[model samples]
Target: MTQTVSIADLMSLSGVTFGTSGARGLVSAMTDRICFAYTCGFLQHLENIGQFAPGSHVAIAGDLRPSSSRIMAACAAAIHHKGGHVDFCGFVPSPAVAAYGFARGIASLMVTGSHIPDDRNGIKFNRNDGEVLKSDELGIRAQNITLPDLFDDEDMLGEPTPLGPLIDVATAYVARYVDAFGTEALRGLRLGIYEHSAVGRDILVRLVEQLGGEAYRLGRSETFIPVDTEAVRPEDQALARQWTSELNLDAILSTDGDSDRPLLADESGTWIRGDILGILCARALGIKAVATPVSCNSAAELSGLFDTVSRTRIGSPFVIEAMNNLINAGQVTVCGYEANGGFLLGAEVRLENTRLSALPTRDAVLPILAALVDARRQDVSLSMLQRQLPARYTFSERLQNYPTAQSRALIAHLEAGSEAEILARLTATFGGIAGEVDGIDLTDGLRIHFAGGDIIHLRPSGNAPELRCYTESDTSERSVANNAKALEVVRDLVIG
Candidate 1:
């Protein structure tokens, strides 16, 4: 007789841990059993709300991890057993799943841990329109799920359906880039791509070549490497330096695991933060209306290029919400994305005739493509273009180990205090107050603005146990330093 795992035991699996972004844990901890039950529950909830129509077709995609395929199969099987037709997209970027969902008029399930380790895996669910919200997750969890036996081999397995011929999604995506800025604009530029483990590697190389620019591919990794564009450690810097030296390249570009986050390196071999890239991309696109996360660097507004600036809570879902509102209200023509520098074009804001209608999710291809074209058009280097932007320092740091309850309480306490009194108290303790912005935003988290273009936004990771604190300023050095100091002050008050 095969042993059965209890629901409590399944939930204890390592993959069950929630992060600020999504659910993620080790594959062993997130067993096939857990995936099936969670998927069943999620689908049932969709059925209840009429989100999952009878015979509705859904798209499934995964990353390059060894376990991704298995998890994708498991989730697809669950959907199939429930009478939903599955259109498998195979291994692709996270945003591609979102784009497919929007384009094909079906919901999407992406199996990826994003920038996490190879041993870890997670799932991101998108409705027919976009990513599922927190409220949706709550509804799914409340649904009654009949957990299947882990060892019940016959009943648990579903028919294996092969995905049709590999779709050249990258080709379609590249065309969108060309449409945004003419191909003639990027002529005669030399670009390098660090393929590593990113799914967008070949696509990025092809994009540059098609644009009439010389392109080189480097640093291809065999193992599933997790690359975080926002937090580049010394090792990543070293690798980038070696690639620059060997390729004699003008710029180096790459993306994280699923290619939703973009990474860029200057000729000098220094990695540019995502927030800085967002500001630069906005300038290159020449858009006056913009919306970004509160955690983003304040340099966006300091550029003096934008006519309307709106700040939302972290996460693309929230950013997309703001973008949709702007589109509906006719306040902006374009939307800007800064979650690690990957910009979502017309698709993000959903324009009818623009190049973005083809893709409505975050993509690493567009910003780099546009920026390269801009550089060639102006006859300037990538770094030179970045330097032309306004000088502002922005720094971000996180305090781990703070309980969710405690973090919320601390934000509530800060908000309840008078703005003047709180500023004076913080100034007295941390030195002097530069400025202050009153009110708390519960949409994503708590964001407090200080005078002189410095900002501190505090929130618990929706998917994890850690707390995230984002800071920004005018100079790079000051931004990094201030972020450290601000995190220290906040940590003391919250934990102590």
Candidate 2:
């Protein structure tokens, strides 16, 4: 007799591990059975919501990981089993999938590990309108469907027909960059690109060269480089330092494995934080209304220039929702990018008579191209532009193994108390409260703002099992010190 797998058992598979932006895990762990069931379930939910139109094409894409193709094949098979047509756009960036979905007016999914090791892979799903929400995950999980085992002959029955080459996607995306900032602006710019297992390496090189810039390819690694632009550790920094010294280029540009997150280094080989890059890109784009995460430093720099500045929870979905609201209300001309430097332009909404609006998703390519254009226009170095921005120190740290329930409880406790009361209580226990915010914005976590422009926000990471602490101040020293102190206080409260 064939054994049946419980829904809970499928969900608990080791392949459902944390990724920089979404779920990822080992290919073997993410069994073909689980992949088919989850994807079919997700599609069923979409159909119930009237999201899946009959004969409406769904764009499918994958990264360069060894297992990515297998996952994509499984996902496509699942879609086919559900009577949905799949348009396979093989080996592309996550943003390209999003763009293809929007442009073609169809739902899509990109199979990728996205900067994780080659041993792992996963999928990012997008509705025709935008990304799948947190609520959608629950609905998808509630879906229960059985499929044949990987070793069974039935596993090969639902093979999907591959869509022809995505030349149009590549052509249109590249053309958008060329049109936005003519080739003249990129003249004489030199970039050292670390093509270390990034899917966008070749496309990025072509992009720079097409716009009259030079690109030097370096370090093509066979193994995946799990580089997070936001959380570059000391060892990654060391690698970057060595590469920059060896190349002696104007800058070094790269992205996470699937090219969803961008990383940039200055001429002197200093890796600029994503938040700083966001500010520079916003200024370059001449956007007056900027929306970014509360964790970013751009608000302080573009305060005077922007008409409306809004802060959201740290995710592209939040930023996109805020941007949509502003667009609908006619409150802003352009939406600002987050610290990760994924610029989503409102103008990109129209292409080939179709209203292709800015996708409410994170993309690494847009901001980098925008910054390059800005640098050429101003005849200044990328680092120089960054230095000219208003100085606001932003520091982020995460405490791993901190239970989400405990973190939520602490946030609730802090929120229930008044600022004065909370400060008083903190002082009575651990010394004095250095600052506070306008009533701990409990929308996502415990965010306290002080009168001196100091801020600390604590929340559990959505993509990881860690509790994250974000602090901002007028100076880097104060930001670091305050973050350390706040983390210590929180730790003592939880552990003691």
Query: What TM-score goes with each of the models?
Result: 0.84, 0.84
Which parts of model 1 are misplaced by more than 4 Å?
1-22, 48-51, 147-168, 178-185, 346-358, 399-421, 432-448, 451-453, 487-496
lDDT of 2: 0.70
lDDT of 1 by residue, 1-496 (tens): 3333343344544437435345577677666656776677667777887778769987888888888887887887678767888787777777776786787777888888887667678887777766676677676656656654442453344544344455445555567666656555557666788899987787778777777778888889878987867666568889888878877888888899888888888877777778777777766666667778877766677778788778877776666777677767776566657657767554233322354453546677666666666676778887888888777655555675677677777766765577677665555544543454433345567666555556666777654446777666666776677667767787667423
lDDT of 2 by residue, 395-476 (tens): 7777767866777777767655566787655445333546433334555676666666777878876554468888777887
Model 1 poorest ten-residue lDDT run: 346-355
What TM-score would candidate 2 get against the native?
Answer: 0.84
Models, CA RMSD each: 4.3, 4.3
